[model samples]
Target chain A: MADDIKILAFDVFGTVVDWHRSIMDEVRSMHLDVDADQFALAWRAGYMPAMQKVMSGELGWTLIDDLHRMILDDLLVRFGVTQLSEEQKRHLNKAWHRLGAWPDTVAGLRRLKQRYTICTLSNGNIGLLTNMAKQAGLPWDCVLSAEVFQKYKPDPATYLGVAKIFDVEPGQVMLVAAHQDDLAHARACGLKTAYIERPLEYGASQVKDVSPHPDNTFHARDLEQLAGLLRC
Target chain B: MADDIKILAFDVFGTVVDWHRSIMDEVRSMHLDVDADQFALAWRAGYMPAMQKVMSGELGWTLIDDLHRMILDDLLVRFGVTQLSEEQKRHLNKAWHRLGAWPDTVAGLRRLKQRYTICTLSNGNIGLLTNMAKQAGLPWDCVLSAEVFQKYKPDPATYLGVAKIFDVEPGQVMLVAAHQDDLAHARACGLKTAYIERPLEYGASQVKDVSPHPDNTFHARDLEQLAGLLRC
Candidate 1:
């Protein structure tokens, strides 16, 4: 399955970057009067529903950055944190742009990049991904996003778009993601899938299930292990 | 004019990569029964007319790779060089992906990237830019292309789209390119413009005029000089 894969498209949020920890740290640094873990989880939780709104045409062609701001506005009210000025609120919403990579992300990506064309196939906007990469030294060959296809994940377009962009068959592109549903969709679209275990993706209180799925072409504990498994 | 800049969007073909020399070298290596210089010039000469076809809606939206291949096929026939196999033709068409970076390209980009977000805003496709960056060690913070905008350079949409993607005002972005026409178009879209001198872009036999335009915010001999001018 790995032999034919020339491009490795990664899922960014939980797969490549430690978004939960990053947001929690940012909340702490800003001295926000709220539970960081809960705030991070709440913010992330709003993501899928907001994307669904776009997918359903309730919100027409909204960027992740805009969707994120919309979620932040509601969260600020629910969390009773009304102290921020507009500039502070905008900066806080841009926390996604300053996300920290997982411990092994940079090194593993550097190794994997030597062999495969490594890129981000994330729902994050281009600016978010680009800034995150620069801050975290992600070393992506390309930064592709839902913004590029104007369609979020689970849409066949996002998965197949990677192959189309590279002028290769879908089989030659591999989706390396932590989410089984994402992998399932990519597999259904005839792309190879690699499951990456991001157990602490939701922070210390929540340990995600890291069990192997039979459908995935490969599975590993983290990017480092994935690189080793790929013999990079 | 430079004070507000947050991103540096670049033109890739002749500005970042030595396409003419690279193509000439490839032609020589292939041992084609044609003059290397003539072959290189002929191939590049087809580029604008081909893009014009796409712009005029005669050919629909086509990727630069496909456009390059079409041009190569025509050149092979025009030069009476029909001995190449399909595989050879395909490989030769990908020479753009292997184009050599100008000597100071990587170092200069690295320096500029320290102070501003540096990205490609080229007519080349994503795959081509990504492959070229991987091969040439270009230190672009993001690999962007006309493929993302679905519009070529000099198009207002393409110039304005970079600012939109980065969520910045057009004035916050500086277009760094060798071509005055590209810079002029970018300036018209409210982007700051920096012109780099690429005297031999067409080859040593045909020197490109590198005279300064007063409308440009900055002008330099190369990327390294541009970096110095920006105090990066």
Candidate 2:
């Protein structure tokens, strides 16, 4: 099974990087008036719908950075946090770029790198992913984002783009993501899928049900276990 | 000067990797019935003209890998080297993916990476660049290619695209290359330029003139000296 896979395309936000905790930490450090958890969750909650607008042609092609900023601007008003200047808002919005990886991410990715080509398949723009990787020491062979394909994940184009980029069959590429929906989409696209158990992805208050599905090719608690399962 | 630059976008072929020597070595190892040096030079010489065809819209957007194979097929016919199977021809074309880095490349890149984002700004497609980096251990922060823009080098789009990817101003991103013409084009796009002297880029017989250019921000004998000059 390990020998059959040539590339492992990871979903970055919740699987590779602990975006919930990372964003929560940033919000806490900022001492914003709103609850840190709520702020973080609210910010992330806007992501999918925002991407949907672009996907539906309701919005012109905008980068994840711009979408993030737009969401942040609305959240600031909704949360009654009005003290930030433009520069402060910009810095706070770039918090996504400083996301720390999960505890096992760096080591697991390094282990996987020894065998399969490991890369980020995320909605994050190239700059955001590159900055996050540099900061968190995620050793990606390459960084592929919606910025590359101009279509966010769950889009067949983004899932299939990985295989096209490497000149391999879709089955030869495995999409490792915490979200079952993402993995299901990849599987539907004829790519193999690995479910990463990120129960705390939405924070401890909202633990996700990481129960294994029969459709997934593999399931692991984290990237370390994924590497082991893949025999990397 | 270094403080002003946020990214160092490198030209991979001659600046980071010694394609001439690497190709020559591969040709020699293959024991092809042709002059290895001439064969290596011929392969590289096909590169620019091929890219120009795509740039001119005479040919549709083509990945460097396909362009390389096209050129390789022509060379195999031109050099009267007909005794090769399809698999052997494919392997020969992938020699580009296995090119060795220059001695100073790894160390210099590590040092420079500490200060600024280091990425590839090359005409090579992502797969070729990613495979080459993985094989050669070129620790690039990101891989930016002509494939990303669907335009080859010397096109203002490729140079400007690097700045756009990093969300930096063109002047904040420096183009580092062994070829002055590439640097000049980058400069014309308002990008800072660093020229690395790779006199043997065309092989030992035809030494390249790597003289200092006044317009360049920095000029060094190699990446090692470039690192030292930048105080990295």
Candidate 3:
């Protein structure tokens, strides 16, 4: 399974970056009276449903940034906080752009890039991925997103699109992600699968499901371990 | 014109990499009895026509790599070269992936990337551009290609697509290239245009049209000079 892999497509957000911590920190700094942890969770809670609306054809194709903004507006109303001006709301929406990467992201990716083409395969928009890379010094050969394929994660088009872009068979591409559903979709689409353990992805207080699967081609404690396992 | 420009989109073939010289080098190293310069010219001469076929909907969308291979096959027949095996032919087609950059590419891009978002806006496919970047060390924040927009250069969609991807106005995005035709198309689409001089782009012996145009937002001798002019 590992022999032919030429492209290692990554799931962004919780896989590569500390989104919950990043969002919680930003919310805490906002001095909002609501529980920052719950606020972060609330903000994230709308992500799947928003993407589902697009996936189900109930909504037109929209960028994750725009979906995120819509979610932000709903969250603010639910949390009973509406003091932010337009500029402030815009800036707050851009917090996704400033997400910090995991401890092993840069060095491990630098290692993995030596052997495989490294890229982000995310639901995020191109601008968000590009800005996040710039902010976090994440070196991606390409910043591919659901926006590029016009479909969200779990969509076979999105998984197969990465392979088509590289002119390689889906078996020659590997999906490295923290989510089981993501890996399952990639695996179902004939790509190799690697599960990355990001224990603190949700937060210190909440548990994230990071169990291993027999079908996974590789498993690692972190990106550094994966790099080592891949002999990069 | 440069004041509001937040993204610098680049043309790759002649502007960033000397394709003529690089192809000539590879052709000469192959020890074919044909004139390497003429062969290189013949190979590139087919590029625009092939893309035009796609643009005119006479052909389905094709990647530059495949188009390059098609042109290479015809050029080989024209030049009376039939000794190459399938493996050799495949490797030769990938010569585009190994083209060397101009001396000032990496450093100047690094300097410019410190402020504005820098990316490739080329007709090349994603795999070709990604492999070329890996081989050339071109630090692009994102690799935006004609493949991404499914339109070749000089098309309004290709130029305007960059602005849409970044959620910016056309005026806030700039097209930096060596070709007058390319810059003109970009300017017509309302993107700021910067013309860089690649005097020996077509090979030292062959004269290329590198004349300046008044409509260019900026003109510089090279990427280093462009960086200096932009105060990066």
Candidate 4:
């Protein structure tokens, strides 16, 4: 069944790149008078709820860039940090574009590219993905995004849109992600699913659930493991 | 000034790749009992009118793959060619993905990529552009399409949308193309424009209008010349 997948749509934030560490490192470099790890968690904690606003029709179509800014503004106040100027706030908001790829990401993706069409299916806007790809040497055949569909992930359209764009059936495309919930949603939309474990996605302090879900077509410890399992 | 441009969005069909020769070669290789060059011309002549249908809302959104197929069907009948099988038709429709770039395309593009965010701003759909990039080794940072905007070339939205996606001012994005009208439209949208001369775009049987347009920001015989002018 894995061999039948023609395109592999990857979830970017945790699966292919380490957003938490990247964001925390950026904050640490700035020497903010706050717990960096906790700040990173606090910022990411708003991602889902922020997307939910658009998904649930509470907000009009919005890019993750806008949502990131909104969350950053609130987090700055909650962390008792001095207010950043417009230029500083803008630079901080673009931190998403500079996230470092996981160690296995580039090599694993290169291997997978030998067989299947690999691209990002992230909530990150096109600018973010393009810049990240350039910075991290991610060899994506294309950079797809939730912005393309004007719908965030977990929405059926986001998964189905990949198939539609590639002119392939849902079953012929696979969604590779670190989150079991993301795989479940892809599976619900009839896409093949692969879950990659990222234990330290949030931080080194908390234990993450890397348990496999029965519905997924493939699950592995990371993209490297996934590539090996796929016989890439 | 040319020095201000950060993103070089390309017009793919003629500027970068020799589409007429490619389509002619693909058609001739089939050994159809028809003039291949004439067939290629007839087929391409239908391109704008077909796109105009969608632009005028006479048709719903459609991919260039489908548009090309529609044009091919009419051309086959008009040229007194027998109908091809479903598989044959599908294979022929994908010839757009196999277009060979001009002599200087790769070297010039590599040079330009060093200084700018290089991407496709073509009328070709994503699948076609992605596959073409893979086939011809066109190293695009991302592939932008009229399909993404659901509007064809000369549409201001298509040009401005490139700026919006990259979060850059229109002046910072240059539209590089072989067509004067395309460059003129980009200029109208406030995008800097570089016009490349593809004298054989329509075929060597007739002279093409490669005359410089006063509104164009730069003019070159090919991408290599453009890169030289930009000092990339």
DockQ of each candidate's interface versus the true one?
0.85, 0.84, 0.84, 0.81
Best by lDDT: 1
Weakest 10 consecutive residues of candidate 1 chain A by summed lDDT = A1-10
Which residue segments of model 4 deviate by more than 4 Å? Answer: none
Pick by lDDT: 1 or 4, better one? 1
Error of 3 at A8 (Å): 1.1
Q: How much is the lDDT of residue A203 in candidate 2?
A: 94
**Residues B97-186, candidate 3, lDDT per residue (tens digit)?**
989999999999999999899999999998899999998999999999998888898889999999998889999999999999899999
lDDT of 2 by residue, B1-232 (tens): 7789999999999999999999999988988999999999999999989988898999998999999999999999999998999989988999999999999999999999999999999999999999999999999999999888878888899999999988889999999999888999999999999999999888899998988999999999999899999999
In the range A184-226, model 3's lDDT, one tens digit per residue, is 9899999999999988887888887778988999998889999
A72-107 per-residue lDDT for model 1 (tens digits): 999999999989999999999999999998899999
Which of 1 and 2 is the better model by DockQ? 1
Query: First chain TM-score in every candidate?
Result: 0.99, 0.98, 0.98, 0.97
In angstroms, give how far residue A229 of model 4 lies from its true place: 2.4
Put down candidate 4 lDDT per residue, A1-232, tens digits, no spaces.
Answer: 8768999999999999999999999888877888999999999999899989988999999988999999999999999989567888788888999999999999999999888888899899999999999899898989999888888888899999999888889999999999988888888999999989999998897768888888889988888888999999
Query: Which of candidates 1 and 4 is the stronger one according to DockQ?
Result: 1
- Compared to the true structure, candidate 2 yields what TM-score? 0.99
Give model 1's docking category. high
- How would the docking of model 2 be graded? high
Error of 4 at A128 (Å): 0.9
